[model samples]
Target: MIQQVFSIVVPLFVIAAVGYFYGSRVRPEMRITNQLIMDVFMPALIFHVMIQEDFYPSQYLPIMLAGVLLMLGSGVIAFGLARLIHLPWRGFVPPAMFSNWANLGLPLYVFSLGDAALGAGVMLVVAGNILCFTIGTYIYSGKLSSLEVLKTPVIVAVILGGAFNFLDIRLPLAFDKSVEMLGQIAIPLMLFSLGVRLTRASWKDSRAGVIMAMFCPMVGVALALLLIELIPMSAMHQNILILFGALPPAVVNFILAEQYQTEPDAVASMVLIGNFFAVISLPVVLFFVLSN
Candidate 1:
């Protein structure tokens, strides 16, 4: 577990450090650069990651379903934690609902378990994205920020990708090759955007935010581990799901908070702190999980 943790963490930290320094150094139109990344680079990466890989899930459906249910279940657990703690309704649910499944969870899964587990993670990510953009947005709208049902990139990406997947259709090889080339830009750019966004925000030691950050992912990681045990799964597959839950807070949480005006600062703090703290927490959770 120590080796596995270091194997993943070391490379990620180095790349993130590079992004931080590079973003600080570059003075070129930041917004334009971000837009280029979001509109072109990241999407290509997502699409490429999904399509280029062979999406075979002979026994993965159950795990995928478990991942979805785990997230929804975590939302309930998170809300209970909040109510018990008695934080304001406005900020509490968003942070809890906005999981770190996509940005942090997916890539790490792909890296750790190869493409098959990543496909499972992708399904979970899509379901989470739907919930985040739709129901979660409903809660945040008129309270924190405006909610537009159709304007989310995650949703758009899923719809297009899913349609093709469901129908078992493939794009032309030439076009697919072109897109694959473009998709290579996704990883570095996604990491770079994260660094740039983090740079723009300032972190404060908000007690409530820190507390929620500690509570939320812990519930998630615990549930995922329990599911791995109770549900019949191979050792390798269980490791994949366990790691997904152990991931840091999703950057989308911060974006939703910023969009809806819920607890952007708090969300930022959760992400900034949650990620840094994951160096310790993830290993702790994964140790019991993997050993079991």
Candidate 2:
């Protein structure tokens, strides 16, 4: 079990470490790289995965529903915690509610659980992104950004890919390979960018960061436990749900915070600390899931 966990976890951190070391030394500008990933690579990956012969978007709907519940439940709890401690809800709740399902969770799932897990992973991203754009955006920007959500490349990929999947349309062989190749760049790039992003983390809000670093996974796992008791799902799906809960705060939370002029610093702190802490939290979660 330990070997299995190590095999899965080490590769991720090693790549991230490479990115970290390089980022620390050179401090390369990442805006264009991040933009390319978002605008091109990630969408290709999603579309490729979505169009697979075995891919059935509807089969993952239950997991997506669980994801929605997890986000909402986390937000509710975060709201209470923020009010109790007098932290701004705008900063705290978004980080607490949304999670790093993309950069960390996607590759982690595929590594630990194998290729079959990709569908569930994609659906989970869909659920997280939808709420992040709609409810999470409203929390910070004071307006429902529904249209903005539609404009996102990832979401557009999901829509197109899902439509193609449902219609049983296959891309021409050469074009399919092209899309797959493009898609392949997203996961590693995501991890590397994550490492680069972490370089910018300020410890100024370390207390809040520590608080959430601990809270996010625990809350998610707790919600997953509750969800499984109420919802019937396959064992793998159950495990997926549990891991979904254990994800750290998404880096996108900080981006959104920055865009909305919210407490970007605090959000950055929470994101960075929460992800670093995931080195421990994820292993424990993986052991629990793999053992079961």
Candidate 3:
């Protein structure tokens, strides 16, 4: 079991560490690289998984619904906590709601559960992406724009991918292989970019960041446990949801915070602190998840 956990976890952090070391030295600009991952690679990953021969939305509908509820429920909990703690909801709630589904989720699922769970993992990511862009944007900006949501490349990928799946359409083998090759770049890039981002994060708000780091996963796992009881799902789905709940805040939360000028420092603190904590939190979650 120890070996299993190490095999699954070490490689990922090692890659991120590489980026961290490089970032500390060179401080590379990743704006365009990040845009390419979001615009090109991530969408390809989503579309490829969605259009897989074995992919079936109906089989995972309950898990998808649970994923949506988990996000909303986490937001409500975070909002209440923010009020209780006298913190700004803009900074606290989004981190609580959005997790590192892309950076951590896809690889974690593939590593822990094997490639069989990849489709389900991607499905959860697609659902989270929709909420992140639509409701998540509204929470940050106070305006919900369907047009804006639709314009997001990941969202568009979900739409087109789902359409292809539902319509029983398949890309040519050559085209599919090309897209898959492109999609393969996204996960490593996400981890490396995450490492670079962490290098730039300020530790001035460490107190709030530490509090949020502890709070977010607790809220998420508690909700996941409750939902697991209420919702009937396969064991694999249950495990996926549980792991999803325990993941650190999405780096995008910091990005959005910076974009909106809504206490970006605090948000960055939460993101960095939460992820650092994940070094402990994730393995603990994996112990239970893999043990079962």
**Best candidate, TM-score-wise?**
2
lDDT of 2 by residue, 144-257 (tens): 958999999999999999899889999999999999999899999999999988888767899899999999989999999999888887788888899989999988888889
TM-scores for candidates 1 onward, in order: 0.82, 0.98, 0.97
Estimate every model's Cα lDDT from 0 to 1.
0.66, 0.91, 0.89
| Candidate 2 local Cα displacement, residue 8, angstroms | 0.6
Error of 2 at 281 (Å): 0.9
Give the lDDT of residue 108 in candidate 3: 89
In model 1, the worst 10-residue window by lDDT is 142-151
Off by over 4 Å in 1: 24-38, 49-53, 56-60, 142-153, 229-235, 286-292
What C-alpha RMSD separates each model from the true structure?
Answer: 3.4, 1.0, 1.1
Return the candidate ranking by TM-score, descending.
Answer: 2, 3, 1
